[model samples]
Target: MRLSELSRRSGVATATVKFYLREGLLPPGRRITATQAEYDERHLRRLRLVRALIQVGGVSVASAREVLAALDDDSLDQNERLGTAVCALPHGKPADADDPAMETARRRAEQLLELLDWGYDPATGATIPAYGMLVTAIAALERLGYPCTVADLEPYARTLGRLAVNDLDLVERYGGTADEQVEAAVALTVLYEPVLLALRRLAEAEESRRRFGRK
Candidate 1:
């Protein structure tokens, strides 16, 4: 397809696609004429993946490019995948031992994880980085004695689990005959906490509007 068509179909503007090309995130298309290039299905697939990582996963452009490159690498092993998952989490410098806020969040994370039975091992079965992040955040809260209890987190966890099941079902609707779709969904699900965070913000905004009787 032409660049314009690729842009339209991908829901990304032509200029944005060009920016991706310039950044080496999207490979150059086949030259068809002096002013035209043809992008194939692979480009479309990759562009969608790129958007998901950036817009959904909240990864920086540089980090997303790096992770995409690693995903495309056929030689990547399980360890590489696990590392990628870790970096995709909400990252920051290591918390200082004296930082009270950070300490509280870490403790709350651990407490909730224990209550939720969320194992923190990255080498385990069906590892989900979002779960790790949530646990970590709860741990931090606990350290501050923020008064979060398992009962408080349980409703949230059940809601998230329902959303996850729905999201997985939606993936199947995309016709997963290809292995890449399955892989993408698996990776996406494992790293989906960012998306969940976005949803929570949206819901909170809407709820605030309703409470104030705003249209």
Candidate 2:
């Protein structure tokens, strides 16, 4: 496919695609002429993954680029590469833990770690990425003086865990190979949380209204 077709098919703009190419996040296409390049389906797939991580997953361009590099590297297993990318982000920005404003932030990291342990699935045994993201979020919260607690996040973890189970079941229903399943799982782990969190909030509001016998 041509660059325009790749952009249209990937649902990303041509300029953004070029930016990705220049950043080395996406691989170079085969040059058919001095000004024309041909991309393949792998490029499309990679673009979709990159878009999901950045636009949906709320990752920075640099962090997303790191993840793309890890994913593109053929030497590691898919899960290991995914884990490396997840771990590579500057999620744990240091702060003055002794500062009153940072106390909550410090505790929040601890609580997030506890939540990761709490939410661990024995079957898949995948917990690192969630831990990485949660720690990062908590660190940001600390900077804002809004350190979260395990008690504060328990309801969220439970709600999100159930939704994750549903998503996992849907992925497994397709009945593909283990690698495909792992790939889908990695995609879901990275991509689904934002959408699920938004929908869950809506559901919680509706449920709260029903319980209160209000419209």
Best candidate per lDDT, number? 2
Worst 10 residues of 2 by lDDT: 88-97
Evaluated against the true structure, the overall lDDT of model 1 is 0.68
lDDT tens string, model 1, 1-215? 99999999999999999999999889999998998899998899888877877777677888777666666555666446535644554454444455655565555555656666755543462245554455556656666677566678888887776886786677667765544544466456635666677888999998988898645
Query: For each predicted model, how many residue pairs clash, with residues at least 3 apart or on different chains?
Result: 16, 0
Per-residue C-alpha lDDT of model 2 across residues 1-215, encoded as one tens digit per residue: 99999999988999999999998878899999999999997788778877877777677888877766766567888667756765644443433335554455445656554566754443443245445456556556656767566677777777776877897798798567654554456567667666667887998998988898645
- TM-score per prediction, in order, is 0.64, 0.66
Judge candidate 2 against the unseen true structure and give its global Cα lDDT, from 0 to 1.
Answer: 0.70
lDDT agreement with native, every candidate: 0.68, 0.70
RMSD of each: 5.3, 5.5
Assess the local accuracy of residue 208 in candidate 1 as a C-alpha lDDT between 0 and 100. 88
Model 1 TM-score on a 0 to 1 scale: 0.64
Candidate that would win on TM-score: 2
